[model samples]
Target: MQEHIRQLFSENIQTMIAAGESLSGPLENAAFVIVNNLVSGGKVICVGEGATSALASHFCQLLLDQFETERPCLPALALCNQNNSLQHSHQQDYLARQIKALGQSQDVLLVVSSSGSEPSLIKAVEAALTNDMKIIALTVDGSGELSGLLNQQDVELKVPAHRRARIFECYTFLLHTLCELIDMTLFPQQGDL
Candidate 1:
């Protein structure tokens, strides 16, 4: 059992390394766009489903609280963090409506999904487009509905993996990287060693 655990750790490390190499460019672009949006007085709105919902909330928390350094709070919101009184169908429409209501042209809609086919996420993306908000998608590789929805101006960070667990892991790492980049860009004194 110990050997198996060690192997799993090793494999995850390898995946992280590969993901860093392949995704660095896209991640940089995402960070740049996110920083521009925030500086322009726009908030980041996150939406995801299932396991990715946790990631969406985590990303917002990191931004609204702090990633590593002490700085002024950044504006962010998790679409999934809503009242439970709404019906299931209402909940599905809640995110779209929220984006349409709160989103601005300078704001960014960050969507996370391992399969890239969640209906609610798709709706959020469409609503963002309708509102003329920028989109940053984190999804697994391969052509899917979510991928198809992205336009040339949008940024899509596609993890080059198939397994859901691995994809989620990569997404978490990417989120952390984004937080770090945001912090570094905003507070240059807190540079990583």
Candidate 2:
């Protein structure tokens, strides 16, 4: 079992390393946008559905908490927080409303949607766009309908994995890598490894 586990980890790491090279440039650009926006007093908002919500929360927390980055505690919110007092439809409405309430024009919205086509997801994306917020999407190659909404030049990062579990695993790996890269870029001796 341990050997099998090690193998799994090794394979995953290799896949992520490949994905990293393909995505590094865009991820850096996204991080730059995020850092600049925060410096200008804007918040970072993350939105997703189902498991991607978990990813969003994890990414948001990591960005806000990692000490090496030395970044201020910028306002970061996960729209999928169950405790957020909004119904599904209301939450959809609130995404745009919340952005307007909390986000500045240059603020960043990192939207992680493997499928990307969920109504709530679409609603949130629309809201982000309407608010003139910069967006960074971490998604899958043929994530079907969801892929359609994403603009290739819009800080979009896509993994080649097609299966949901594969996509989810790769998504988390890529996001963590981006965060690590950002931290390294911002603070050269941050011990990112």
Residue lDDT tens for model 1, 1-193: 9999999788788888888888999999999999999999999999888788899999999999998777789999998636678877677677888888899999999999878777778888999999889899998888379899988878999898777778888899899999999889988887463
TM for every model, in the order presented, reads 0.93, 0.79
Clash count, predicted structure 2: 0
Backbone clashes per model, in order? 0, 0
- Kindly report which residue stretches of model 2 are placed more than 4 angstroms away from their true locations once superposed: 1-14, 67-72, 81-94, 151-153, 189-193
Sequence-dependent TM-score of model 1: 0.93
Best by lDDT: 1
lDDT of 1 at 51: 81
Per-residue lDDT for 34-102 in model 2, tens only? 767766777778877778888999988877787345654546777653446666667555555666676
